[model samples]
Target: MEGVSPEPLRSELDSKSKHDTAKEDDDALKDSTEAEVTKIRLMRAFVESRDPSSKEENDLMMRRFLRARSLDVEKASAMFLKYLKWKRSFVPNGCISPSEIAEDIAQDKVFTQGLDKKGRPIVVTFAAKHFQSKNGADGFKRYVVFVLEKLCSRMPPGQEKFLAIADIKGWAYVNSDLRGYLNSLSILQDCYPERLGKMLIVHAPYMFMKIWKMIYPFIDENTKKKIVFVENKKLKSTLLEEIEESQIPDIYGGQMPLVPIQNS
Candidate 1:
């Protein structure tokens, strides 16, 4: 864990600790809310850059990070408010669940010891200039979920029976136009039979693809194109490229249990 990022562990879950039932608006908490926003940014940058020797080490670091949280600090309600904007902010709106997913996956592999060696983030970076959420105030915000299940890897010799898994996370913008455009233009647009149009969607579990493709023929042409299938390996590499190979806190927790889909 020497070189690993601790951003995720250091994140601003302050507001989430307590159920924010302040239904009536409180404009009074506005000023300090902005300050917490700054800390969130700082902490986010810290978490995404955490690099560890192996997935196990990364997992330990994350566990520790979670335990280190202090309840004294107040979470920025304003930040969650950004989720209401949907045009420019990057936050959660509603959850995207695969209609059905694997109950679980195998575990206990030796060679791939740490998080980095076994983690694969299923990410989708859309080119949306503006977006807004259809889900109103009552909607849930999006967050990343990383799961690892013991899995077979295409390795050679003694390393052949390696374990690896999918780490899936969704990024959203709040108070931004970019969010709305992305959902409308890319995801919910099409009846693209082969949701796995390219290797882009391979990271998505089998059930998601199945439902996505099943409803494909009902969507339009342009939207279907956005539902591309990408390789897990390439997605991470691309992130590295974008940041000039800088380490971010996105670590692999456990082995991701992937639902196998037969290639079309």
Candidate 2:
């Protein structure tokens, strides 16, 4: 009797302890959210101070950079500023015109017709149809921007990424464009962070694997995770896993026809 508290007193103490623990957890969560918000505001201010002409800047865009940089405000700010500078110089007129990339578009290699299960827009590229342009790297670079911007425009609200399918079935050495591939990787990774939802490489032959091996090293770890090489035997079934059969392109045994990127 002398060693224990009364039953009523013990019950009241237990309830108070539980309430205190819950309050502590709530306070911690609130503090963490406020800290993140503060960081985002600081980053927005810093980026705007450096690039006042960034009319398209907003919290969502800033958040993308922040997430890409693991929420490091300084690093995200620097990356965002670099992107702004590159966009200003490369896209001086504000957007890449179809006429400017007419040759690449005429190749009809790139198409976008449907969305994945996640609602991300789909982009299909027929590598066999793409030949290295006589106009050099600049034209191809602009073409990449054009295609990417077009795909981005098609994204629905709240969706920030798109899916890619590269059909290299008939690809040969003649279709090889190492510089073009490197430029594309650089632009996608550096300029358009977190924009690629996934990339499906279909019917990739032995020669293509060698090219991929070379290109693979340049891909960042995060981007590399999104790439998938579908087996020939399971191409249709594999594609069906992430895309509705109706939305898959006819060429891949799905219902939809391939719409050229320029047209879509």
Candidate 3:
């Protein structure tokens, strides 16, 4: 008892302990962030080494790949490198031009309008309007890239992903292009990892299910989870839940008119 500290000294010690704990937590967080930054730097270096001509990609883009691979530097690096290779070969010009996809552009099927409630850019595709081109699947593939690039360009600051609405109200077997669908899926999941915030497949007829079944197996598990087949009756209400009425397109019973991807 003689050596014991008084109550005021004990209270001061307790306060100091709490302060130390808080400082430790903050230091830990800072260290974690620094470590991640280092990893991103390493990933960027690896990508650039493989693709000498690669335009410098931003940290946020690298972070998307890193997160997709659970922050495993090796896996993220590999994925990012593959993307660079694909871009170099597929989009040799750096960006898909409207002229290259003139036929698909003329279809006026793809549109990008206002942002969703969460600020993600909205892309609406009329599946019925898509038909297999006589030229081949390459044109469609380029069109997909063009549309995606346009959507990415429209993304608001701090928003990295986009919302897509696939309206298949009149889609029939004649419009089916399995090759194009598969190719588009590959580009989205492999080349553009983590870029899709959500996709609503509205008015998906029973016939579409057959094609979907074949395509579903090829989709990444995470991507499959983001795909929602909106019920016909619930289309408007369900969309309103995630998108504001003002942003919804006129065809879907909302006010906004669909802006062509080339123009949007």
Candidate 4:
């Protein structure tokens, strides 16, 4: 998945350089940080100024759009409006209820797997379990949004992104649906934006590499930087770098089991 932001602008708020020393210029760093904050405030004000909804325009939600567009106010505003319009049309009820996604949820292809060391939510998807159905491409998009909403609900303060692990152990040519992947990617990268932290692909077979090459060009460079491919042998070590072993599933050499999604 990908968004519109340039690499530097995307990390302006969250990343720091390792070359910095005790003699580093504090004033310049402070100024840069202040400017980013100002942009976020301006973007929030711009959106709230044109709309009448009082849902509280905090930095967290508005930052998603700002970061999505690389902090360009005009583009970010347009993206934000487009999101609101899409949400209104796609989920007119203001929320996607369980009944709306009953069919997709029944597959149990996706589920929340607790939080990582940084407090970012971890969502696991069994790619082998996902298959294209006669219901068509829209079903996949709805399922993507449903999984997103479910993960977002578990986010607490100071957390703005989530991690995803795609278990492609049994994934094959039959399970590879390019259209579904593109549509879902568009929804997440364009409609959602800046919500993905890292996407770890575990148990990726040689055949999946060919499929990845096809999908690679569609992914944004910034988003590509967030993806990591791990061999089954090294999956545990790689995941344990960012996620605690206790929070990971037993299938990945961790103590936790694959928790079932509880119906509400």
Pick the TM-score winner: 2
Q: What are the per-residue Cα lDDT tens digits for candidate 3 across 1-264? A: 587769978899889987775564345334346667788888888778787654456667777788678788899988888888888899998899888888998888998888899899999999999999777988899999988888888876567789999989899999999999999999998888889999999988899999999998999888988999999888899999999999998888898988888997
Model 1 is weakest, by summed lDDT over 10 consecutive residues, at: 101-110
Better of 1 and 2 by lDDT: 2
TM agreement with the true structure for every prediction:
0.22, 0.85, 0.83, 0.82
* Candidates ranked by TM-score: 2, 3, 4, 1
Error of 2 at 167 (Å): 0.9
- What overall lDDT goes with each candidate model? 0.29, 0.87, 0.85, 0.75
lDDT of 2 by residue, 1-264 (tens): 587769978899899987775565345335235656778789988888888965456565676677678789999999999999999899999899888888898898999898999999999999999999878899999999999999989987667789999899899999999999999999998888889999999999998988999999999888999999999999999999999998999999999888888888
- Candidate 1, residue 86: lDDT: 37
lDDT against true structure, model 4: 0.75
Lowest-sum lDDT 10-residue window in model 2: 24-33
**Candidate 4 residue pairs that clash:** none
Top model by lDDT, which number? 2
What is the full ranking by lDDT, best candidate first?
2, 3, 4, 1
Model 3's TM-score against the true structure:
0.83
Model 3, CA-based lDDT:
0.85
Which of the predicted structures, 2 or 4, would earn the higher TM-score when compared with the native? 2
User: In angstroms, how far off is 54's CA in candidate 3?
Assistant: 4.7
Greater TM-score among 1 and 4 belongs to: 4
**Number of colliding residue pairs in each model:** 70, 0, 0, 0
